[model samples]
Target: MTAKTLFEKIWDAHVVAAESTDTPAILYVDLHLVHEVTSPQAFTELRERGLKLRRPERMLATLDHSTPTLPTAANGERPYANDEAKAQVAQLESNCREFGVALHGWDSADRGIVHVIGPELGVTQPGMTIVCGDSHTSTHGAFGALAFGIGTTEVGHVMATQCLLQRRPKTLAIHVDGQLPQGVGAKDLILHIIGQIGVDGGTGHVIEYRGPAIAALSMEQRMTVCNMSIEAGARAGLIAPDETTFAWLQGRPQAPQGAAWDAAVARWRRLPTDAGARFDREVRIDATAVKPTVTYGTHPGMAIAMDAPVPPARNAQEKRALEYMQSQPGQPMQGMPVDVVFIGSCTNSRLSDLREAANVLRGRRVASRVRMLVVPGSEAVRRDAEREGLHQVFTAAGAEWRVPGCSMCIAMNGDLAQPGQLVVSTSNRNFEGRQGKGARTVLASPATAAASAVAGSIADPRDYLVEVAA
Candidate 1:
């Protein structure tokens, strides 16, 4: 038998029909996660075609992109961003009910971001193929699952038949060599990778992150890294399953139990790449060389170390990004005034991320001119943080404690930055107007966002880490 890469192992196992040069392969989908933003149209397609869902038991739904992060009003209303947002939520509810799919609706304590709750409930596992209508679905690949985003048409197709036609993507091996320096994390490491490879570096490839540095990260941190693979133009990202993966999944609500758990682990242990498995391409980085990084332009790839100045634009597109960001070549990102700071997103909204931010803001206060928001990725995360007094740490530091929702990350949930305001955000994307019309977004990690909130500038998290230690 030929040695197989982790990706090939999973892909081959899930292939219902093999791929040919002219046609795509028919692949089985293990899980289909649904959300309000993208599923309504897909559901409409299904209804129009009179197609009953093929596997309702394999589907999970949630309302996040359009749900309000602020608390309900005195009237017990949800405070939806708009009537359309409310309608989208309602339609999803209707669709899920009609299709007999389980939904984590507003009344459910489990309600949260689709990506966040999937793993929280242990539904995401090794060697499974998962798809969602959202691009950040790559986050699920952290569990060694073959996960990727699908379009509305694909969503409908998957609902009608629990399979998808997929063209094979070349595998790219990203090897991180050394331990990350203090104050730098998975978010910074991914940003550095995008900087090195450019935005389209992983086009037509599924990246497999491996190395001692990757092995050193916690499960949540690995998820954080995988979540942003879409921003690099990758079809998906994966990390081989290990003891760390099993430990995180063990005893979770939906995880296998007793002998089943033991058997699952035994099978998962075989999912990693074989010794001689070959990748289409490989890139290596020294994790120690990566610094706490931030994006200054309109794309995730336009990033630099927090201590460095903006680099000269290499092309017309880069120049346009700099102009839109109100920055000139050689302008320093550090100490640049920011009007807002956001410390939550699927990219970095887990308990570990909140704790990292809280450690920076524990004894500090947000700058008087800065507006800071700390939104959890899920209800469970919110409850856990409250139990740990993380919410109090944020609020006491002058940041608003928001409920679980996509919130400002999508800027469609009424939490948005004002025009021309510079926002240091922990969200994955930094595209212009992503947070709001004319809002300048600087993507950073949660700790970096917290530091920037307190400093009212694009400050280095290492400085705050020193203060936190002191």
Candidate 2:
């Protein structure tokens, strides 16, 4: 038997019909995640063709991208200000029911960002193939799954056949050796990786994150790292499942139970890459050297250390990004006044992310000049945080506590950073007009966002972390 990379192994397992190794292959999809923003058109396509879903049980639908972060009205409808937004969410509910697929619709306790709830519900598992219309669907790859995003037409294809035609991608191994220093997190690590490899570094590859530091991350932390794979131009990012993965999946509602659970664990334990597995490309980073990172310019690739000065532009695109951000070379990101602080996204809205931010926020108040918002990723995350009084901690610290949704991650759904305002955000993208038109968005970790909210400027989280004696 030949040693195979995890990506090849998983891809080979799902190959249903293929003309050649390089040509299109019909691949079986084990899980299909859907959201209202992209599913409406796909649903229309399915309806136009008079096609019924091939596997309704494997399809999970949620209203996320177009959902309102504020509480829904008494009638249980999302309080979307725009008629189009309201109708899009309604269309999803109608479509899911029409197709006999289970939906975690708006205001449902299971309702949340599709990516966040998939793992929380145990629908995402190791060695499975998952797809979503949303780009961040690569998130599920953290569980050793082969997950990727598809287009609306592809969404319709998956809906009609529960399979997708794919060309296998080359593999890249991102090795993060050593232990992370204090205040450096999965968010910082991934940002550093993106900065080192550039936005298009992994363009033709599916990346496998290896080495001791990646192995040390909690399941949620690993999800945070893998969630941003698309930002680096990778098809997907994967972390081999281990004891941590099994521990997180054990008792969840959709997870296997009893003897089946044990069997699943035993099988998952073998999904890691073999000792001699080869990859097409490899990059190594010393995790101990990674600092608390922040994106100074438009793209996620233009990241710098929290305290380091922004380097001179390397090209026209770099120069343009700095101009759009109104930032000059040789200036550090710290001390720049922030108008808003947003702490919610599939990238960093897990309970662990929230708890870290709340720890920095206790007894501290946001700057009077800044508007701060913390939206949980899921109802389950919100419920867990409230049970621990994290909501009170946020509210008392002068930040708004809102419902779970993909709020402020994009400029959509009425939750937006006002034009000309500078926002320190936990959301992934900082592309031009991503948060809102003419909005200057700076991306950082949740802890960093919380600290900056209180400081009213781009601030380092380490300055705010309370040292606990070991």
**Alpha carbon lDDT at 60, candidate 2:** 96
Write model 1 residue lDDT over 294-365, tens digit each, in one string: 998999999999888899988998889998898767877988899999988889899999999999899899
Point out where model 2 deviates above 4 Å.
Answer: 19-22, 74-77, 467-470
Cα-based RMSD of candidate 2: 1.4
Worst lDDT 10-window in candidate 2:
461-470
**TM-score, per-candidate, Cα-based:** 0.99, 0.98
Number of backbone collisions per candidate, in order?
0, 0
Cα lDDT tens digits, model 2, 48-165, are: 8889999999999998888788876799766795999988888989998899989998547899999999999999999999999988988999999999999999999999999998
Q: Which residue pairs in model 1 clash with each other?
A: none
TM-score of 1: 0.99
